[model samples]
Every structure is written in C-alpha cells, then in structure tokens.
Target: MTKPNLLPRSSDMASETSAEFSWPPLESNPEVFTEYLYQLGLPSDWFVGEVFGLDDDSLGFVPRPAVAVIVTFESLKKETDAVAAAKVDFFMKQSPKLDYACGVIACIHSVLNSLDSITLVENSILEKYYRATKTQSPADRATTLENMTEFQEVHTSYASLGQSSVPTAEDDVKHHFVTFVQNALGQLIELDGLKKGPVVVNAASSDILKDTAAVIQARIEAGVYSDSLAVLTLAKVADDIDAAVQALIDSSNGVLEVTSVENKDGAKVSRIKCTATGHEMPPRADIVTAHVNSKRFKKATEWYSYDFAQFEPYIVSHRRKPKCLFCNVTGIVLNKIPSEVEKHMQGRKFVRMKEHVKFFDEAEIDKDD
Candidate 1:
C-alpha cells in the first residue's frame, strides 16, 4: 500500500521536485477498509490533495496547498463550518477530481451496505422499523398503521424471536443502533447512485463468509454439496485455526514430544529431548548406578568412556601439545593419582628413586651368585 505523501517538499537548489503525487495504499480487504473509514471519524464527503512550498520556518504549520476534501450535506455557508463539515480533510488544499471523489464515496457505500446486512441478521425487527422510519415519508395515523402492522409481522415471528436472544439489553440496543446506521447508509447509497461499482468488503470482518463456510461444511457432511468447495473453505479456516494454535504454542514455548517407559522391575522413567542441544536423556538422572558389583564396574567403565568421548572433540581441536605437570616433561602419561602412575605431570618435581634402584641392584646380584 502506498503511504500518504504529506511530508513537506525539500527546497534544495540542486534538486528538482515533481508536481504529481501518489495515492495512499488502498485497503484490499473490504472488512478492514470499512473499519479504517469509520476510524477516520466518518467523513460526510472524502477529499485528497497535494501540498507545496513547505519550509523549516513554518514547522508544525498546516499548509494551504495540502489536499483537503470534504463530504458533507451541509452547505459551505461559513469558512469555519465548511472546513469542519466533514471529518476527513487531507492536508493539501488542492481539490481532488470528481472521479476520485465518486470512487471513494462508492467504496465507503459498499462497506456501509455490508455492515447493514450484518445488522439485519443481528436484529430484524429493529432494522425493519429503522428502515421504515428513514425511507418512508412522514404520514398520518392510517399510513403508519400499515407500517406498524408490517413491522409487527416481521418482528413477532418465532424465527425472529429465536434470532433476537441477544444475551443482554445493551446488546439489543447496540444492535438497534447499528441497524439504524445501516438503514441510513442504504438511503445514502441509493441517493448517490453508488450501487453499480465493485463493492469490496474487508475479509477480516466477513461474518457472512464465515457463515457460508459453516453451511458449506454442513452440506458436505450431509452429502449435498461437493467436497471441493467445502474443502477449500475448510482450508482457509484451517489457516486461521493454525494461527490460533501457533499462538498457544508460542505462549507455552513450543510443543514437547515426550516419551514414558516402565521397566520390568516396576520402575517408571521419562525422557525428553532438548531443543537446543538435540540430546535425549532421562529427566531425573544425570548418571545412574546399579547395586551389583559387576554392574558397578561396567557402569564405571561406561562412565569413563562417555566422559572421554565428550572431551575427545575438544582434545583434538586444541592447538597446543599436552605436557606432564610434575617433571615439566612432554609425552608423559596423564593420571589423577600419582601413586598408581609412573610418569609425573609438568610443573612439579619427580620422586627420588635412587635408593630404591640401589637396593634392587644388590638383591639382583645376590640372586645371580
């Protein structure tokens, strides 16, 4: 969608400025478009314009060249009243063409018409009375009697009563108000002759489409309509449903695939996969040991192997050579216990073995003789 170009034009001497301006991006969906129009404060008429010659000194100033269109029933008798006649007045003072004005009016009319249909479905009786009041000319008691009878007939039916169970008095009142607005808008569209053009309704507010989808699904289930249309509509709803499902997923930090197991010994175990590390393990235990001595030895060996495997990547990737700590010697065995090992690590003194060596030599010579 093209954004409104209401920003001031630069006056740099080195640059050239164009006179033509671009239109703002139109809302494609009818439902969203209608809501946007209503949000703009319901203009009696619509207008667009182009502005020029804005400067830094006039910061915060509303330029006269800015487009200002008004859609109002009131005559432009006074300057102030004319400016305030419609809720919408684009910043530029330049007048839009008649065709542009008509197009905007038609778009607004279509949305109002759709809203009217929804209102009728919500409240039939009140909507009928509202339409009569707006469309029919003022009449005597006799003329009103016919309208009164028709209104009663339309409202008093069992179907209408069933549809009118609106939960609360406030809901009924709101429905009546919307119905009245819808009736008024219908008259306006007829008066403006805006019924022929393409009427786009915002898909977001398309309750009719939702209703249609439900009906299609029901018919398909009953073997009436073909599966194709029903499937397509369902697919659309599925997209929306998936979005809702995804919201729940997002709120809870994604879905978890869990596994439960029970051993023959009646022990229960649960496992979960970590998303970050892609590793699966028992939920409660980082390490487990069995009571059997043989099993204990096997478990210890497995634990050592696992530990070594975990460190292998780091060991292989390291750039520097490993050295012994006790004697500051390279290519020596690395061990946790000094008494069970022969080689000492670098950075410490080696044990004195001269006395042991002399005793061992004397014992060997005596044995040989």
Candidate 2:
C-alpha cells in the first residue's frame, strides 16, 4: 500500500481574505526562530540565538561571525515609523492583508540578505519563494508571499509552540520586528517590511552586529519597546564544526588514539599511546566497572558511536566499550570490544541506519511533548 501523504493540503488549512488574513504573533525566543529558519531552508549549521544585551560583556556572548540580527520592540504608535527610506538594497513590503506577520517577514529579510553565506536546501519552501519573488516588484512580492500556503502552514505550526497564551487573529498587537543586514555594498541596513525601503544604519559598518546593538540600545534609551524589547541573532553555529569535533578527540589526553587494538576472547584491549608523550598508557582495569551505564546511555544504538562526538547521536562510548541502543532494545549481543566496532561502523547496514536513528532520536527528544 502507498504511504499516506505527510504534507498538509491547502484545503486542510484555514483560508483567509484580505480582511481576515491574520496570523497569531510568533514568539521572539531563540528556539522558535531557529526552527523557523531551519524549516524555511536555513541549514542545520546556522541557528538563531538570543543577543542578551548591548553591554560589552553581554554582546561578548554573541556567537562570532553572526550574519543577521532581528530585534523586537513594542511600538506605541499605530502606524509605521515616518523615516524616509533610501537606496533599496533588499526590501519586500509586507502586504496589508498579512496581519501579525512582521516577525516572519523580518526573518525572511534575514535569510535573503545572508544568501552570500547560505546554501539553501534544494527547492525548500523558502528557496522556491525566493526565486518566485526575486524579480517581482515590492508590491507583487508581498502579494506572492501573502498567497503562499506552505509558508502559512509552517508559520501556524510553530506559532502555537509559543510559551505565552495564543492570541486570536483579531487581537490587536503593537509588537513589531525588524532585521539588520549587511548589503552587498558593505553598508549595514535595516529591513522593515513596514518601511518603504531599506534604511541605511551605517554606510561603512566595520561590524554590523555592534552597530545594530548601538541602534537598538538607542531605541531603548528613547523609550521604544520599553519592557517588551528583545534581540535575536541568526549566527553561524560554528566556523568549523567538524574541525572542532576533531580537536575534541585530539585533546582527549591521549586516551582515544591506539597504536594497535587486539581482541582477547570477548574483550578488546588497546595499547593506548599518548600522542603528547612518546610513551604508552595501557588500558588498565582500575576499580571502575564501566565509564557508562545502560541507563546513562540514551535508549538508542549506533555502529560508529565510538568514532567521535560527531557520531554521538548514532553511538556512544562507555569507558572503551562502544554501546549501541539498538543492541539494548533488540537484545542483540553488543559489540564487546574496540576491534569489533570498526567493521560494524563501516558496514552498509550501520551507515544506512543514520536516518532510522535520527527519526528514533528525535522521537526520544520530543517524548516530553
């Protein structure tokens, strides 16, 4: 039998007219916005995180090489700010029909403007939406976004996860969001869908984030956003994730490396050579039973979990013993030694098991839900 179709059908969604096209306000929290970008084609490598404050100590917490910043404020005025827009770098107006959409609109601006550093997922919802609106006039682009059904579905799903009580479409909201992006010309500009065009914040912005903080701080001092003000930044999770993982393995104090691994019956012992020193550190049976326990190990399994942290989601090591949750649940003989780990990790069945583990792993994490 054919698998049931997983995607939401347009008919399954709440339809809207210009007068009734209101979405519940999205939360400005990091996890919510990070998932927003991921669903809209932002890769797992980049994530949205909160920028705690404008002070040097607080700004120091910001992840380095951040691409875009989105700040939220409660506007006391009923209308958009009366600032004159100029030199449109990248600006798409939010259709008047798309109410309570400023948060999502600001995120779109963040990703589109960061395309220089982003390689979007193939034909992801945001990728297609970008191609469709790239050449359109600002008004037409807004109309296209207003009619996009997939986006509407994704928005509604995540919006419900907000910690605060959900508001109805007709609820009046004064909170608004805007993004700060660096244009191709190296100028830091603000993209607010409510504005006529890009607002130039800094012409020669040596650092867009610090400059954005300055702008946001000024607004705060002037009584904008008052209690509801917040800042969220879309930043590269790490400059080199793989290399970072490698460094962790390398700095294991010479515990990970082995000149040779020999299996003695059911147990495998390695002649661990300290790379830092030219001497060997034997895998001794001190007093400890095992570095990990079945309960300490998540209820999952993997072939290469012994390799390094990058493969952690797949497998994990307790002492030198590589444990797999697959074995635990299935009552199969766990790989008892280091030497046995290599062949299993390299096996086609184990390699193909990544997605299976991923699905199972996500289920485990969201079990609380």
Regions of candidate 2 where Cα sits further than 4 Å from its true position: 1-21, 77-89, 239-369
Would you estimate the TM-scores of all the predictions?
0.17, 0.59
Cα lDDT of model 2 by residue, 251-365, tens digit: 5543345455443223344444433223343332110011111232212222223344443444444444334222322223444344454466776767665436533566777
Q: What is candidate 2's CA lDDT for residue 25?
A: 81
Model 1 Cα shift for residue 179 (angstroms): 19
Give the Cα lDDT of each candidate: 0.26, 0.65
Worst 10 residues of 2 by lDDT: 284-293
Best by TM-score: 2
Q: Across residues 1-369, which tens digit of lDDT does each residue of candidate 1 receive?
A: 999643221221112211221112121222233223323322312112111112233211211211111122211121111111111111111123111222233332333334322233223332333333333332221133222433223222311222324232222121000000112212211113212212212222223323323433454566644432201100000111223223332442332223555533355545443332233333211111111123533443333333332222212222242221222223234432333223331233323432232223577889999
Off by over 4 Å in 1: 1-35, 40-98, 115-369
